[model samples]
Target: MLLLLCLSVLSQAAKAQETWEVFMEKIPEHLQVSLLIQDEEGQTLFSQSADKRIPSASIIKIPILIALMEKVENREITLDARYSLQATDKVGGAGELQHLPDGSGITFRYLAEEMIRISDNTATNILIRAIEMGYIQDWLKKNGYRDTQLNRLMMDFKAIEEGRQNYTSPREINDILLNLWEGKWLKEDSRAEIMHCLKGCADNSTIPSLLPAGTVVAHKTGTLDYVRGDAGIILGDKPLILSVFVENFESMEEAESAIGKIALKAFRDFGR
Candidate 1:
């Protein structure tokens, strides 16, 4: 058994080395990359600028989902509870809520699903209202995510212009997924519910684009004019918790392609 473990360690180290070389060679010069990958045992297989804070885009919704789940687990909120969408609630971005009629009532569960699955902007704002932003910020800080902050709601262009954007580090988000995968800080059922939401994510343009078909990846993706980020848990021979973020890209397609290549390298190396 000890010899087998030693072989596995050596294999992982070699894979990391190869992946590092690939990244250094292929990643474009215009973008900044932050990433972290961990095996099931919580050993970091690869990392680069993992501690740097960057704009979160819609990925900040993950923390919001976590806070909402905690509220549900504590009996402070009910998933079936409905909230009415005002004309003011509608915001433009990646979701169907903006197209829905005003005064339509949606349940917390449905809104949460939309937020993660489609990266819904309006659904996200409704959730922020349901579970106040203060609680979300407090939860992230109390949970040891020092670099993540929820400072503004989705589609708040004014806030963005004011420099009050949401932010998170690759390391912090990867750790969040690791905890969720292991059911460490949350009850198993709560963690399961969160994972269920994550699995519904529809944006397959980044990490999932290059992964083999039908790979079980429960993840969230965030995008902006110049930023792209994807983080998730990939179930394999040795489950991988991978986070990849690229910022300041000249184009989003290039950013996503870079992330896909990075994720594919890790998947091939560690998953095999």
Candidate 2:
């Protein structure tokens, strides 16, 4: 009985790999994509270029979020710690905080929530300053995220020009989500807080786009002129951890549609 079960699982994984390979081949030749899908048990169902590092865009926020939560868990910082917004802290892009006056004060909890919920650039920068970029980088390194880095602040065009862009890989992201799912590293309450914010993520055009309505997804999205990506856990009978990144794409619509198709396919194949 044990042998039969093992064979059955291997057969299913092989079939899923074939399906994903063929499906990926159908995407346009101009788009470069790296993808990985894993079951709740951290078993890889399908993968393609999973370790290839790609520009992370706002997806780098995931590491930032985790680092912040880790600090809170260690009592190095409190969520209620307040930050006074300064003109220099504001950045123009993907956040409401940019519109608020410089004197406005906000708490760490609010900044973290806004960072994930709305992909707020200003809120992210403030948190980065509060937590200190060195600590976040050290946390990521200590946690084994080799291909993920917080190299620059959000909306920093000058850094981009200097090639100091942030980056992450599909496999690393899947691992991050899997650890979160298993309650590794952080305490349960800290994990729950992160999930709550991710569940409220405003952007759903990628991984969750093709999933059924009200499908619970705790995810983050990243976008740049040449990059589009999403990574998250899909909650259901057969929960899945999916990470898909597309680079060098000419059309955002086409790239996102490709990502959606991949996610929907994973949902159906693994949910069985």
Candidate 3:
């Protein structure tokens, strides 16, 4: 009995070592990586640094979408509410809406879709400015999300890239996605619409590219060089909510590839 117990303990240790090794090796040396996978049935399959605080990049839009949906839920904003493009709202990087002529107008709902699906910088800031930053802050505090916030509009210049205000963690973003998809964010239809929009997200660099093509993942990708992030719901034969945030990568591709490796691991292990 003693010898058998010793062998069992050794096996457990070896398994733990392997788990840590996957994270340590696939995450890249000296990079900050937070990976979390929660079965889509609403159970956490894997979590590490999933909640660890880190820079959000475009992943911040996940919360921004929630805030906007709250406005819709409260009847504070209408789906058809028309918004005109503002020069001040435009931010450089990752989107084309900024360069479109100022006369273009879109509905509040469409803005939310564009912002989350494409990580459209201009659309995100515009919606945030519409809801007012304070509203988003208050919503975060009221909800279960303790570590998510937008330090500024997508491109406040002084705040996100150079300022101390902009940052978030993998766990927070994952929770946001889970709540959004779990039908907890808004009325039934509203929640469905939000998830539907996120499902259409165009940036498929991280989780989307890594998973089986038919697998439905409603996720967004964030990148600011050395830092790359993707957080969303991964629906396979068995669904899961996952967040993979990598910082200090050598390049955008490196960070993205790191995320792909971790996601592939989860898919293999959790789905099997």
Tell me the tens digit of each residue's lDDT in model 1 across 1-272: 99999999899788767758676666787678999888877788888898999898888888899899999989988999988889999999799999988889899999999999999999999899889999999999989888899999998999999989899998999888887778776798888889899999999999888888888888999988877899888876668999899988888888989989888888887876
lDDT of 2 at 246: 91
lDDT of 3 by residue, 136-208 (tens): 8888878866678666777666665566565677767767776776777678878877778878888887887
Q: How big is the positional error of residue 253 in model 1, measured in Å on the Cα after superposition? A: 1.2
lDDT of 2 by residue, 1-272 (tens): 99999999889878867877888889998888899989999988888899999999888998899889988988887999788888888889899998998889898999999999889999999889878999988988998888998989998899989999899999998898899889888898999999998898989889888988878999999989888999999996899999999988878999899999999898888864
lDDT of 2 at 171: 96
Instruction: Itemize residue pairs with steric clashes in candidate 3.
Output: 40-239, 40-240, 50-171
- Say which candidate scores most in TM-score: 2
Worst 10 residues of 1 by lDDT: 16-25
Global lDDT of each model?
A: 0.88, 0.90, 0.77
- Prediction-by-prediction clash tally: 0, 0, 3
Error of 1 at 18 (Å): 4.9
TM-score of each: 0.93, 0.95, 0.87
